[model samples]
Every structure is written in C-alpha cells, then in structure tokens.
Target chain A: MHFMTALRAAWQQRDSLLCVGLDPDPARFPAHLQGRSDAILRFCTQIVDATADLVCCFKPQIAYFAAHRAEDQLEALVEHIHARHPGTPVVLDAKRGDIGSTAEQYAIEAFERFKADAITVNPYMGRDSVDPYLAYPDKGVILLCRTSNPGGSDLQFLEVDTSKGRMKLYEHVARTVAEDWNASGNCALVVGATFPAEIARVRALVGELPLLVPGIGAQGGDIAATLAAGRTENGTGLMINSSRAVLYAGKGEDFAEAARRVAEETRDAINAYR
Target chain B: MHFMTALRAAWQQRDSLLCVGLDPDPARFPAHLQGRSDAILRFCTQIVDATADLVCCFKPQIAYFAAHRAEDQLEALVEHIHARHPGTPVVLDAKRGDIGSTAEQYAIEAFERFKADAITVNPYMGRDSVDPYLAYPDKGVILLCRTSNPGGSDLQFLEVDTSKGRMKLYEHVARTVAEDWNASGNCALVVGATFPAEIARVRALVGELPLLVPGIGAQGGDIAATLAAGRTENGTGLMINSSRAVLYAGKGEDFAEAARRVAEETRDAINAYR
Candidate 1:
C-alpha cells in the first residue's frame, strides 16, 4: 500500500492521531536494556507490539541510534515492527537537510537503509536540499517550520516582508514548500503545538497539506488549542507527536503496557476534537 | 592545543588560508581504487601526504564517507592524516543540527567518532540545538549562513525585522550565533563565497569569528571578490574551501599529485588576497 493509504488505515483502526516518538536515550532506556543493541531492539519490539494498536504511527529519532553506530540495528528494528504489523507507518525523525548530492545520500540512508514511510527534515538549507527526499512518490517529507524548543522563537517568528505583505518567517517557508517544492510527491510541515495562533496561520499558508504537530505532552502545550488550530476538516491530516511523555511512561518491566495507556489517552484526546 | 591556537599555527606554516575538501565520490574515485574501503583510505592518505604542506587543513565531507556506511574506515582515515602530519586540522563537513540531546550525539560522532577538529552545522534548529556542540571547548562549530548552492538565495537572503534593526535572515543567524550561542567556546560562521556583499555584511556583524568560506573552485565564485568581502583586518580568520577542483584533479594513479598542484595554486590565490 502507498504511505498515505497505510497511514489512513492505521489512524482509522487505532482511533489515533497520536504518533509516539521512540527517541531512546541510552540513559533513559529501561535499566535492564542499557548498553545492548539487542535489548534496545527488544524493548522497541515490545513497545511497538503494545502501542501499535493505539498509535497512528511510530517515530524513531535517528540520532539516538546513530550515536551508538546502531544505525543498521535500528533499521532492523523498524523493519521488524513493519513486518509484525504491516499497516503501521514509521517516521524516521532525522532532521537532515543539505545540498542536492548530500541529500540524495541521506535519502538512501532513510528510505533504503531504514525503509521509513516518512522522515523529518530541516529546511534551513533551502529547497534544493530537500528536493531529493521529496522525489520519492510514496514517502513523506515533513519540513521543519516552527520547532518546540525555547530558543526556536529566536528566528522562526521573525517578521519578514514578502511580495504578499509582512509575514512570519515560517509562513514564507510554509508557502514556499507548499506551492513550489511539493510538486513531485508527499510533503508536510512540522509546526510546533506550543504556538497555536502561528499554527493556524501556517495552516492557512499550507492549505491542505498534512502537518506533523509536535510539543503536545512533555512540552506543556495545550491539546485543546493545538487541535483547534490544526485539525483538518477530515480529521486525518495532523500527526500529533508525543515523545518522552509516552515512551518513558514507566521505568519497570510493564513499561510497554504503560506506554499503551498513555498512547490511548493521547488518541482519545485527539478523537475528542472530532 | 585549543582550536584557535592550532588553527593559527597551521595558517602560518601553510602561508595560505585554504582547505581542500576530500569528498571522494565512489563514482569519481580513481578507477583502480573503486569498490575498496582500503583504496579510498589510501587515496585520502596520499592526498594528505601530498598537500599536507600546501593547505591549512583537509575537510572530508562526511556525507561521502557516511553514504558508504564506512564510518569506522573514515575514522581511521582521520587518524592516519593526523599521525602522518601532526598539526593539520581535519574539518568534518557534516551539516548536522537537532535538539540539545541529539546534538550532543552528533558532537560525539564528529569529535569522537571521526576526531574532527571542527564540524559544520545547520543553525535552523536554533540556539539550544547548537549549544551542545559548542560545549566542547576545543571543537569548532561552523554555522551555515549563506551556502554556495545556486538556490541558496531562496531563504538566506530574506529580510527580517529584528530587535536590533532590519537584517538578512543569514545575517540574523550570524548575529544570534556569534552573540548568544558562543558562550561555551569555539564558534564560527560559514559565509559562502557566492554572495560577496552578504559575506562582508555578516563579517561585520559577527566580529572576529573565523569564517569558513566555501564555493571557491567548482562553484564559479570569484576568488578576489570573496577575499575582499571575507578578509578580517589581520587576514587570519578565513578558511576558504575547495573540493571538486582539487580532489577530482585526475582520474588515474597520478591523482594525488594533481590534487596537490591545484591545492597549491588555490592556496597561492587565497594568500595573494592579503
């Protein structure tokens, strides 16, 4: 199945718009699973098994694995999850952006090495840095517009004069990516949930393109406001990501089940918006 | 030695402020050296040996090595270069940026995994994302401002309203990075040679921070104009980079010598700017 169709099916079956982020900090991995790639893989396996029925997708932050040079192992873990549950999409959270040649290599690493359905990318390097990734018809490229961190506001919210009028920097980025660089295939914007009004404004610029909304749980963002600003008329275009709040739900052996509970709560909250 | 002192010594010895990039594309690797990691390592070793006295540094584009999953071999190549000629700094050209936690991992990968004295970074993720890398007092973080690519003007030259005054987006980046994010230690700006006036303006904003200027040789940027725009009063703060022009000098066994000749010529052209 194509990525969008598989994403829709998973969202429908799980009744979830939540995307659980598996950014396994070695320091935060269950005590028993520390320092072993196999244990990390198994922990991811159990988490996927339990939360797979509750989340629309899983997003594995690639740096956590890359630090240990466990890139291939993480690739296998992502593949294992898909093999076990064929319809759940995986979004590899690697914020990569460079020139065209380098971007092509990164595309190979994300799509061929890891087989991710979608990938997060930084848009700072300009449109050409992202073209190689968006060239793939079945994959999704979520451009970083406004990030969740405290310092993100330093530059992302700067007002700029465009041909249209005075606009937020992110609005220009959203307009450019939506209208120009998104022709060949799947493209989405990453708008932090912390800024609800900006989210609505960016949504206006992006029109109908899907958005990956981060900062809902651990980042202290209001779910109601985020949903109010970001929800599409069809209720399927937003992927709300909750990382530490869901992944580190429990420190003990029942961690996977605890993750499922958090996932369920997140899913229910998103569903309430409908 | 600290990065600044080390860079200073290398600059004096080479009598040139040039860095040759070792981005060995597999398709462009010598025919005799194709399909072998050892051959690639040997190719890099000979280039270092040949141009060790002519250039200030060697910048191996990490994507070229990373694309092959030859991370360990690349690490070995770095060690080989340092051991053969002790004072030459290795600049790992990987434009990495993410959150604080993820950024720490990239710092480890560049400073520990590859042992690069400096690494290029994307500033789109904001201050916290860059702070982790800056925490390493001895390793330099080169922030991407105006890149050399044809489409770089898409976002870098954006006019933004900031608290200080009206500024280009990249100028804003340079100001933020140089003023706010340079607290922990080593920091530099990447001002591409493609935009001469922006380079001069960013240099004025950044004030004395080293600038790693790319886009010299293969990118059609005029060397004399780049020198006039990028040079500090002391003429000691620029690391001009040339990759394809030097690395792809020849396709045969004589490639290393050809690389050295071009590196020498390029170095002379840069020194003439003073």
Candidate 2:
C-alpha cells in the first residue's frame, strides 16, 4: 500500500492524530530494563505495544539508536512494529541529505535496511538530494520546513527574494516543495506546532499534504492553536507528535499502562480539536 | 592536538592540499576484491595506504560504507589512517544535523565511534543543532555552505535580506558562522570547487576559517580557479577533495597504484596553482 493510504487507514481505524516519537534514551529507560543488552528494543516495543491502538503512526529518531550502537535493535523494532501494528506507518526521523550517490545510500539505509514506511530528509542540498527519496513512491518523504527549537529562526526565517516575490526562507521552501516537488504525492512537510502562524502559512501553501507536527507536548505548543492552524478541511492531515510526555508518563513498572493512558488522552485531545 | 593544527602540520609536511575521499562503492570495486566480506575495508585501506603520502587528509564519506552495512569497516578505516598516516586528518563527510540531544548522539557517532578528526554538518536547522559538534574543542565542524551539485542553486543562490542589506543565503551562512558560531575556532565551511565565484565569496566572508572544497576531479571543478578563489593568504586553508576520479582510476589489479598516481598528479596540480 502507498504510505498515505496506510497512514489514512491507521488514522481512521485508531481515530487518532497522534504520532508517538520513539526516542529511547538509554539513560531514561525504565530501571528494570536499564542494564539489559536489549534495553532500547524492549523499551520501544513496550511503548509501541501500549499505544498501538491510540496512534496514527510511530516515528523512531535514528540518532538515539545510532548513539548506543543499536542499529540492529532499531531494525528489529521496525519489524516488530510492522508485525504487531500492520496499518500504522513507521516514519524514521533521520533527516538525512547528501549528494546523489550518497543520498541513494541513505535511501537504502532508511527504507531497505530499517524498513521505514516514511523518512524525514534535510533540504539543504536541494532537489537532486531529495529526488532519490521521492523516487520511492510507496514511501513518504517528510522535508524539514520550519523546526521547533529556539534557534530555528536563525536561518529559516530569513527573508528571501524569489521570482514570485519576497518571502521568508521557510515559506519559499514550503511553496517550492508543495508545487515543484510532490509529483508522486508522497511528500510531507515538517512544520513545528510551536510556530502556529508558520503552520497556517505552510498549510495554505501545500493544501492537504500531510504535516508531521512536532512540539505539541514537551515543546510547549498549544493543541487548540495547533489544530486551528494545521488541520485540513476534513480535519485529518496533521500528525501531532509527542515523545517525552507519553513515554515518561510513569517511573515505575506500570510504565506501559501510563504510556497507554497518556496516548489515549493525547489522541482524545487531538480528536476533540479536530 | 587541535584539528586545525594537525591539518596545518599535515599540509606543511606533505606540501599538498588534496583530500582523498574514500567512497568505496561496491559496484565499482576492482574485480579481485568484489565478493569478499571485507571488500569495503580492504578497498579503503589499500587506497589510504597508496595515497597517504600524496594527500593531506583522508575523507571517508560515511554513506558509502553505511550503504553496504560496513560501518565497522569505516571505524577500522579511520583507525588505519590515524595509525598509518599519523599527521593526516580524517574528515568524515556525514552532513548530519538535528535537535540538541540528537545532535549529541551524531557527534558521538562521528567522533567517538568512528574517531573522525572533522565531520561535515548541515546548517539548515540552525545554531543549537550545530552546537553539539562544536562542543568538541579539538574536532572540526565543517558546515555546508555552497554545494557543488547542480541543484545547489535551487536554494543557496536565493537572495536573502540581512541586516547589512541583501546577499545570498550562503553568504549569510558564512558570515553568521564565521562571526557568531566559531567561538572554539573549530568551525569550517564547505564551499564547492564547482562554483569558484561562490568559493571566493565565502573565503572573503569567513576570513581564515578552513574551507572543505569538493567537486574537483570527477565533478569537473577547475583546479586553478578553485585555488585562486579558495586559498588563504598563506596558501593554506583549502582541502580540495576528489573521490571517484581518484578511487576508480583503474579497474584492474593495479587499482591502488592507479589511485596513488592520480592522487599525486592532483596534489601536484593543486600545489602548482597555490
């Protein structure tokens, strides 16, 4: 199935807009699993099992796994997610970009090696760097537009002059990717929920393209404002992601139950806004 | 030793500016070494051994090894370079960037795991995304400025309005990184050898900061123009990299010798220009 079709089916089945980010910091794993060799894998599997019915997708940030030399565990986690939760898509948040041949290698890394349903890519190197990812029509390519961090504005908010007119660098990226790219209909934009106005602007530029909205929970973004600015006409094009808030809801052995409760609450909260 | 000090010592000792890129494409590996489990490692070590005396630095593009599930080989290659060619620096061309915590993981991947002396980074995510790499006072953080690819113009050439009036986006990056972000003096800029004018512009913007210049050999960059545009006042601060042209110069049993010959010619060509 195409990435969008699978994503939509999961959204409909779970009635959820929440995407749980599986960023398992080894230092933050539950005490029981802390010393285990498979700690990250075990922690991520529990989180996925707990929240499978409450999420539209799962995003595993590759850096966390890479840091611990657990790439094999990452591969296992994605396969487990596919086997246990068939419809819910897995987006590997790798944000990789490079020249042509190197970009092809990254595509193989994200899609073939890790079996990610979608992957985030950096747009700094422009079209050719991104074309290899977009070539995978069954997979989604999420390009960074405007990020959530405090220093995001350092370069993204610069005013750039284009043939159309003058617009912020992020706006230019949104419009160009929405119009010039996206030929296969598998492209998505990453617009931080903290920047609701920028989210609205990106939504306007790229009509119903999926926006992976981070910063809703731990990054201090308001859900009401995010929904007001990011949702599509039919209210289904946003993936509001919350990592730390849902994963660390409880410190003890009931962590899975706590995660489930938080996931359900976040899903309900997003649904209420929708 | 500091990265720049090591790099300068190597440049002065070798009397060369060429950086040999060890991008071992399995499909392009010589016939005798093709099917071996250690093909990537053997191929790269052979190239490094052959060309170590001719080049100032060895750049192993991580994608080439990562594509083949040979990251262990990459680690071995860096260790080999450091042990065999002591003064020469190894710049891992990773082009990685992310949020703070994730960026720290990437830094560990490049520095601790692979033991690269310098690593390339993408600047689209701004200051905080880059700080983790900069925190390593002895390592080098080479930021992507004007790339050599055809699609680089799609974004890098866009005119952006800064406080000091309008300039290109890449210029702004050079100025900001040189002026604000180089507190540790470990920062460098990647200005493609393919665009000599932009290289000159970037060199002017970031006064004495090192420039990692790719696009020299197989990418069709003019050596004399690159030297004229990128060289510092003392005829240093430029690392002109060539990958395919040097690595795949021959397809037979003498491939390593062929690589050494090409590397020597390229190094001499660059030195004559300087």
| Winner by lDDT | 2
Evaluate all candidate structures by whole-model CA lDDT and list the values in order.
Answer: 0.83, 0.92
Poorly placed runs, candidate 2 (over 4 Å): none
What are the chain B TM-scores of all models?
0.96, 0.99
Per-prediction TM-score to the true structure, in the order listed: 0.95, 0.99
Superposed Cα deviation of residue A194, candidate 2 (Å): 1.1
C-alpha RMSD values across all candidates: 1.8, 1.0
How well is each residue in A1-274 modelled by candidate 1, as lDDT tens digits?
Answer: 6677778788678778888888776677777887675776777778888888888888998877767777667878888888998899899888887878778988887888788998899888788888888888899888999887777777788998887788888888899889888886488888988888988888778777878888888888878888889877777678899988988898988888898898888889888985
Number of backbone collisions per candidate, in order? 0, 0
Query: How many clashes does the backbone of model 2 have?
Result: 0
Residue pairs clashing in model 2 are: none
**Top model number, DockQ:** 2
Quote model 2's iRMS.
0.8
